[model samples]
Target: MANTREIKNRIESVQQTRKITNAMYLIASTKLRKARNDLANTRPYFDALRGEIKRVFRTAGDVDSPYFYPPDNNTPLEGTYGCLVITADKGLAGVYNQNVIKEAEKLLAQHPDTKLYVVGEYGRRYFDQHRIPIEHSFLYTAQNPTLDRAREISALLLDGFLTGTLKEIFVVYTDMESSLLSEAKSTRLLPFHRMQFTPPAKEKAVQEPFEFYPSVGAVLNSMIPSYVSGFLYSALLDSFCSEQNARMTAMDAANQNAEELLSALRLQYNRVRQAAITQEITEISAGAAAQRRTFGSEG
Candidate 1:
């Protein structure tokens, strides 16, 4: 059994830790709320952008645009696969970063000729430490996702796609289903797949015959980049929200564990203190009895 002083110190240490964890939990909660709001607010615009792209693909038939359909099945997979990995900049987010990295690793292992384009400091540092080759690294972009930032990343990716450097592109990120549930997922971003677009019976294409100012291909070229940026930006926001949610959950658990530890330490301290006091009382009683006997004998 530890002495009262030792147990008291342990209790104080746990209390301090509890305070830190509680503060972190509160911080994460606030950030999570903001991230959720931002994600929700941008979702509509993202959906509209995707809808417009799909509509364009549906309207423009037999246009030899690479962005309209998936890569040719007959074409052998020979080019390097580009993977954009999204992770958090800091730790203390539980398994948030690890899960996404593991997902990316699995995908990369399947394709030996792959290049990593990491977003966030954590992923970049992790890959560098592991001696993995990084094609490009973007830092400090995941937390505050914006159109401009997304555009920058899109430009790089689009250039690679246009140059045939990246045969296929995919984004590995954490998809947040809810506050308590999130899963790391890999989504193909390039070699755009054809999605079946259904329109309302009331809204017919003949009723709204659209004419392109320059050409359909020119319009598509502009729309494709914007659409890609929006998609990537949405992924960034989802990842940010997931990171906050994970951190909040982890901190809440840590705070609870600290409370339990503090309770046990306090109980130990009380037991040790009571034992010391009882021993002191026993010694005092024995000394008094001996003194009283000696005095009576002498008298």
Candidate 2:
């Protein structure tokens, strides 16, 4: 009976766990859908801005801009580096936070003189627990990534780079390749490299000479800030989407495991119950036989 009671308690616990996990799964699914829509809406704009920047650099001959390259070639080996790490604020997301934190650690290892700017609580906690100093941390931004928030983060990084406080800047986050897949990736956000752009084929319409509002360099200078903000925003969206997807998958798995455990526990409980019933029947029969033997002796 005790064993049966314990099993019953376990069954109840599993059921409650399953309920929580199933609810979490549904919530994550809803968040993932919203994140996906947000990503779809902003991705094209960012892509276009990026492409235009590259095109300008390609066609505009002999352009010089502070945004195009690092301040100097002779950056000291011990120069401080800036790392922006994006992670989920909450846990139970199946390594979504760990991957980004690990990637950030790798960057920190490479550049020991680093100022950390974290975008989530998880990374901040990990770094704090490890005794790593964080220069800045933005909370509640990952859940709802916006252009204004991206610009705010970009401003900090840009100021550090331009002022020679940080020699280079890197952003570490998890990228959502698909609903089922997420991968950690790092992108250098500073010391921009000029991309090699190929001209369109002759079959395409001949492009005309384009004129910038002021000059190509000036236009680039003006656009670089917004471009960086857009890039960061895109990364934030990807990381947010990845987190949701990971949470959904984790909760789904937990629910399934709970169901399996409940099944096994139920079977054990049934067997124990059958054994108890059989023992009771045996005891009753033996008592009746003893009474009948006493009656025969009396006669």
Candidate 3:
């Protein structure tokens, strides 16, 4: 049975909270739409690049390239594995950061000697707090994902792989399957095999013979880096979209809960106010009747 003032304050607080959550929801929605549009805008270029790579593989038979790691290449790689973990910069996005961090932990457990490359401040802090060593942290890229950032990341990874400092590279990110569903998953980036780019049997078309300017190997060497950059860019976009969607959902739920709380608080405030008014009226009526009785007796 709190006083009306206390209830009114609570109601105002809930209303303020509701306004913040609603604003967050709208912001997240806008971000999500922009991310989707950006992805859509860049998709055709990547699709063409992928198609070209597939064509090269199909037309150029038995090419020797540094990017292609065949199954039977017995040359053991000398370095440890590298993993790039993608996470959101800030949290509030209901379990989005947690799920990706859990996925990264699983990977680290499996590859104990992995070199960790983190993308977000949240992931960097989490790993640091847990005493897990981070090889590198790409600052300010998680929130503002751009082609330049993706290219920079891919360049570094390619350099490590080329220099034999990292044997294999993998990325852990969240994929937005739909507006309501997102899954944290890992994708291997380096030492790509030809089978991965090969078109399916059903989708295969007749390949026309084409000649490369320098050689097939040289052409592949040039194309592989762009392909890798494109792949990384797509992964970043997916993770961003997933984060936005998760935030939107979380904010929506918060807004609803705030509304419910405000409703209850307002009801309680009305009840308390009515009771106070009734009590005051009762006291006034009783006092007046008593004074009238005194006057009547005096008269």
- CA lDDT of 113 in candidate 1? 91
Q: Candidate 1 or 3, higher lDDT? A: 3
Q: Each candidate: RMSD to true structure?
A: 2.3, 2.7, 2.1
What is candidate 2's lDDT per residue for 24-118, written digit by digit as tens?
Answer: 99998898898788878888987787778767755664677765553344343457889899998889999889888888888878778888899
Candidate 1 wrongly placed segments (more than 4 Å): 70-76, 196-208
- What's the candidate order when arranged by decreasing TM-score? 3, 1, 2
For model 2, give the 10-residue run with minimal summed lDDT. 197-206
Query: In model 1, what are the clashing residue pairs, if there are any?
Result: none
> Against the hidden true structure, what lDDT does model 3 obtain?
0.88
How many clashing residue pairs appear in each of the predictions shown?
Answer: 0, 0, 0
Best by lDDT: 3
Clashing pairs in 2: none
Total backbone clashes of model 1?
Answer: 0
- Model 2, position 167, has a per-residue lDDT of 79
- Which 10-residue window in model 1 sums to the lowest lDDT? 68-77
lDDT tens per residue, model 3, 1-299: 79987888888888888889899899999989999999999989999998888888777647787787874774535569899999999998999999999988897888787999999989999999999999989987587689999999999999988998899899999999999889999888888767877778787665666989889889989998998898899999999999999999999999989988888888888888999999999999999999999999999
Per-residue lDDT of candidate 1, residues 1-299 (tens digit): 67988888888888888889889889878887887787788779868976886576557654456654543453435778899999998899899999999999999899979899999999998999999999999865567877688889899998998899988889999999977689999998877655433345455564365687688778877887888898888888889888989998899899889988888888888888999999999999999999999999999
